[model samples]
Target chain A: MTYSIIARCPHTGRFGVGTTTFSLACGRRNESLRPNVGISKSQAFYLRRIDPFVLNLLAQGYTPAHIARLLEEDDPDFEYRQFGIIDRENNVFAYTGPRIGQWAGQRVGPYYAAYGNGLAGPETVEGIVAGFMSDPDAPLEERLLRGIEGGRDAGGQRFKGQRRPERSAWLRVVDRLDWPRIDLRVDMHDRTVAELRRIFEEFKRCDAYYQECSRDPRNAKPEEVVMSELSAA
Target chain B: MTFSVIARCPRSGRFGIGSASYTMAIGAHCDGAVRPNVGVTVTQSAPLLRNNRLALNLLAQGFTPQQALRVLAENDAHYDYRQIAIVDREGAAVAHTGTHVRQACGQRVGGGFVAVGSMLANDKVLDALVAGFESQSRADLEDRLLNALEAGRDAGGLKGSKGPLPERSVALLVWGKHDYSDIDLRVDLQDGAIAALRRMYVDYKPTAEYYEERARHPRNAIPAMEFADMLKNKQKAMS
Candidate 1:
C-alpha cells in the first residue's frame, strides 16, 4: 500500500512529491515529477503511464482536473487506480477508485493533495493532509516530509492485521534546474518515515554544496562545511 | 518500477516476456536481449543494464540458464541485490533473487516459464502468474502471457510500502520462429498499462499478421485497406 503527497510551493513555483510504499524503489516507481510542469503520483495499482500522461497534460496547460478526467476516461480499470496531480499553479486534483482497498481516500487542499490506501485508518490520510496544510511557513520539502511522517504516526500501512511503517520511501523536489533540487530515497529500510527525515536533513545539509557547485565547482570544499550548518554557507 | 514475466512456449518454441514498470519506455530498459532459438533473460530490481547484455551474450554462447546465472553472480559483487530470471533455448528456466531484495522476493521455475519479482506485496504474485500460465494450455501464447499478468495484478502483484499499488507499466514481447518479435507492443506509460496492452494487442494483431504474411507469402499478402477490413470483419464475427 502507499501514501503520497504532491505539492507545489507558491513562493517558488516548485513541484515536489514524497511517497512511501511497502514495495521497494518507491522513489523509482510511484512518483513522477516534470521539473516545471507538476507532480503526479500513481499509487493503488500504480501504472507507469499515469504520471507521464498527467505531467504531459499539465505541461500542455491542462488543469489537474482535466488531466484526471482524461485518465479516467481512457482507463477501463479506472476503479482500481488512485492518482493525484498538482499542476504548476498548485491546483490539486485527485482520484480514488471505488474498488481500492479499505480506508482509501484522498484529501486535496489549495496547493497540495495527500492520499493513501491500505492505511491503518482514515486518520492516516487525514493526518497527512493536516500536516501538509498545517505548516505554510515551512519549505515545501519539509512540509512534504512532515505530511509523510504524520501519516506514519497515524498508521502508514497495515498488512496481515498489523500496522507497520513503510519499508521504502522517496522524496523529490524540482526547481529551476533540470535536475532535482532534492531527490532522496530509502530503498529498503524498516523505518521509512524516520529514514526519510534523516535523508532530508542530509539533503538540507548538502544544499550549500549544491549551490556552491552550481556557481563554481571549485567553490565546493567539503571539509570546510559543517553538518550542523543548515543555511547557505 | 516494474514487474515482469519471461517464458518459452515448449510446444511452439516461442519466447516471450510481459512486464510493467513506472518508466515511460520499459521496452529498452527490460529488453532481456531475447534471441530466437537462443534464450531470454530479465534482470530487474536495482537492475544493472550490463547484466542483461552479459546474460544475453552467455545465452547466445549456448550457456545454460544455471551456468549463466552462476557466472553472473560470481562476476558481480552486487548480484545479491539483483533479481534475474532466465529461460534457456532448451526451455530450462531458472531465477535468482538476491538476498538484499525486499520481502517476498524470490522466483518460481515452472514447466516452461520462470517468474521473478522483488519488492512485491507477497509471494502470491508469482504463484498467481504461474497458475495463470499453466491453467491456459489451450490458449495462444499471447493470451496466456496477458492472463498471467492479469493474475499477478489480481493477486496484488506489487504494492507501495503503505498500501497495495498496482503495477505502473507493462510490456509484452513475443517472437514466433522469426528473429523479430511478432508481438512487440508496449503500453509504456498509462494508468491501465496491462489493459492498454491487451487492447493494443487486439488492435495491432492485424498489423502484426500483415507483416507475418508479407514475410511468409509476399505474393498473397493483402492490401492495407483489405487487411483493415478483414480485422473489422473478424471483430464483428467475434462479437
Candidate 2:
C-alpha cells in the first residue's frame, strides 16, 4: 500500500536521514534525525516510538545489530517494518518485516542503505544501491537520485487498485556535517522515475533553491553580502 | 486554506523575520532571513523561489519591506493569491496576502511585531501574537519570538493537526538586532544546500565573538577562553 526510500549520507561529521513514502503524509510521520547522534528511518510498519528507542540504544553505546534485534523481537510483525539505521560508527543496519507485501527488500553499503517496500521487486533496491555505489565520480545527491531512479525503473511500488498508483518518494542525505540538509518531497505524481530525476537535478543544483533566492547581497540591501544561487555540481 | 502575514526587523546589519503559518511546516517554509541587509517571509503558498529571489534583490536596492512587496506584487502573476512580508536594513516592514486569500489574513500590530495565521485556527491566533509582541516589554528577538509562538498556540492551534500539534517548535533563521546572533536551522529535509555558511556572527553570542577574535588580532582568544571557562564554571557550579 506504500513505497518509501530512505538513506543516510555521512559527510565529514554530519549525518542526515532523508526519506519519502508514497503513503500520503509519509514525510511528516516517517522521518527523524538527531544531529550527530545517528539517523533512524522507520516506515511501512512505522513505529514513531522508534525515534526515542534508537536514541536510547545509541546512548547506551549498543551496536546496530543489538538495536535491530530488539526492534525485531519487540514487534510482533518484526518482518513487516522497514527500518534502516546508520550510527556515528558508520555501521549500517536494516530490517524487513516478515509480513511485508511482495517485492519488498533492502540493501546496505559502506555508509548508507536503500530500503523500499511494495517495490517492483527485490532487484530494484539492489540495483539502485549497486548503481549508486558504482557511480563513484558523481556528487552525493546525484548518486542518490541515480539510486532512486534505478529502483523506480525496476518496477517500483506496483500499480494496482487505482488506475495508476501515485508514485511518491523523498530523498535526503547529510554531507558529513551532522546537519539535516537536502530535504525534498513530491507528495503525489504519476510520472516515471525519469521525470523525478529532472526535478531532483534542479534540486541538486540548488538544494535550497526556494530559500536561496535572497542570498544575493544584490538580492539583499547594499550592506548584506552579495550572495547568489551558485548551483553545486 | 492558510492565512499569514510576515515582516523583517532590520537592525542595521543583522535582520530577523517573523511569521506564523496555519500549517505545521510554517517555520521551515515561510521564514528565511540573513544578517546585514534582509529578512523575508513567504507565507500561504508553495515556496515561491521567484518572488523570494526578487525580494532579496529589491531589498539590496535599498527598498524598504513595503517597496519590495509592492514591486514583487506588481510583477507577479499570482500576485493576488500570494502573501508576503519583508523588512529591509532599516526596521521598515511591509506585507501582502493575496486578495483571494480568505479567513487567511494578517496585519502588524506594532513595530517589529507581525502576526499572520489561518487554517482552522481562531483569528485570535494572530491577535494573541500581536498582543504578546506588543504587550511584552521583552527586547530579545529570541524571547519575543518564543512568546509570540507560545501565544498563538495557546489560542488553540490545529488542535488535531497531522501530528499532536507542536508543544515545541523552532525558528530557523533569527538575526538579533542588539547582538549579531543569526540562527540558520534546517529542521528537516533533502541535500547539499552546500552553501558554506557562517554559523555565528562576529559580534553577538560568545561563540561568534571568540571565533572572530581568533581570526583577527593577537589578543588572547578572549571570548574563546572565557567560553571554555564558562563551560567549566557551569559544570562546577552545577556540581
Candidate 3:
C-alpha cells in the first residue's frame, strides 16, 4: 500500500518524511510532523489521527518505543495499521499491523525508520534503509529522497495486480518552522521515484535561497543566487 | 513549459494533479505539494523550489490560497518567472501565471481546481483539461485526473511537442487521506507516454481497493490472486 521514511536531520535538527504508494497522496494521509515534537506516519489502513496522537505523546516526553506501545494499547484496530515514529532526540520506532498487505514490515537505523506494506518484496524496505544510511552527512531531505528512491528501485509497490511501478510519491522536510521546508508530491505519476529525484534536485538548488528568506523575508533577494544556479545548470 | 491541473474530489476529500510536457518528467519536477486535510500547491514554469517551499509553508500557516500566492509574490525577487496554483482544504482555489513564462501561458481557477499551462499548442489545452474534470465529476479522482490529461493531450499539449511521436514525459497524481496515493504514476522520456500512463492506471485501479482493505481489515484481506488471472482480465479488457 505504502512505503515511507522518517528521519531526524543531524544538520538542522529537523524531522522529515519521504513516502510513496500505489494509492494516492501518501504524504498527506500518512505523515504527521510538529516542530519540537516528533514525526509519525500511519499507513496500511492508515488512521490519520494516529500520527497526531503519536506526536502528542512524543511531545509529552515518551520514548519512541513507549509511544508505539501506548498507541498499540490504545487502538482496537491496531492490527490493521502500519506506522513509523521518530522523535526529536533521534529515537526511532516502527510497527506493522498484523493484517497489513503483503511484503509489509520496516527497518530502523540510528536516526531513521523505513517501512512499507504491500511492497513488491523485502528489497523495498531494505533498499530504503540502506539508502537512508548511505550518506549520513547529506542533508535530511536528500537522504530521505535517496531512501524512497532505493525502495522504488528495489521494487516499490506490489506489481501482481497492476503496473510494476508505484503511481504517486511525496517528500517533506521540516526544521523549526511550523511549515515544511520542502514539501513535494507526485500524486499520480508513472515514474514516481524518478520524478521525486528531479524535484529534489530543484529543492537542493533552492535550499540556500530558502534559508536566506527564512533569515530575512523582508529583505532577502534570491534572484542573484537563483540566476547563478540556472546559469550553472 | 507544460500543461497541468490540480483538482479536488469533493466526495472523497482527494486531491489530484495531472500534467504533460515536452520536458522530461515535468510533473515530477514542478508538481505540487498536497496535504490531505490541509491543501495543495503547485509551483511551475521557471519553478523555484524556494517559492514552492514558501507556498506550502504559508498554506500550513493558515494562509488562504490567494493570500499564499500574494505572500510568495511579494517575497520573491523573480516573481514574474513563476507559475503557481493552490487549492485549500475547503476547496477554495487560486492561480498565478507570470509574464516571464513561455508564450501562450495562462491559468484558470474554478470551484475546486486550477489548470495552468505554458508553451501550449493552444489555450484550448487548458480548456480541455477543465472540461475533462468537469464532465467526469462522477469518476474517481484518478480517473478524473487521467481524463483531464487525456483531454489535454487531445487538445494538443506542448507546442511543437506532439505528433504521431510519443510525449517526452507525463505524470498523474491523486492524494487521499492515506499515506500512499490512490494513484501515483509517471511516464518519463517515453513514446506514447500518455497512452502508457492510461494503461498503467487501468491495470492498478481494480486492485487498489483490495490493498486498501488489507490495510483496514487484514483479517479479511483477500488472498493474492494469480498474476496470470489478473493479466488475462487486463488483456481481455485491452482487447
Top candidate on DockQ is: 3
Please give the lDDT score at residue A74 for candidate 2. Answer: 73
What is the C-alpha lDDT profile of model 2 across A83-151, one tens digit per residue? 888787788887777655545678877777888765666776776776566675666666666776666
Candidate 2 segments whose C-alpha is farther than 4 A from its true place: A1-20, A29-31, A159-166, A175-179, A192-196, A204-233, B1-106, B109-239
Whichever of 2 and 3 has more TM-score, that candidate is 3
Per residue, candidate 2 scores C-alpha lDDT tens digits across B1-239 of 23333334423344544443322223445322343445554544333544655777677777777777778777766565455666555556666656644443455534644555534355677787666554555355544554565566566543222322332223334654422235433212121110101111111234334433443332333332245457557758977
Best by TM-score: 3
Per residue, candidate 1 scores C-alpha lDDT tens digits across A16-61 of 8888876544564322787788888877665554676677778888
**Model 2 TM-score relative to the real fold:** 0.48
Cα lDDT tens digits, model 1, B62-176, are 7888899999889877677678888877888888887866566678888668877765678898888888777787777777888888888778776545555555457677777
Better of 1 and 3 by TM-score: 3
Q: Cα lDDT of all candidates, in order?
A: 0.71, 0.50, 0.73
> Order of candidates by DockQ, top first?
3, 2, 1
Candidates sorted on lDDT, descending = 3, 1, 2
Q: Give fnat (model 3).
A: 0.12
The Cα RMSD in angstroms, rounded to one decimal, for candidate 1 relative to the true structure is 17.1
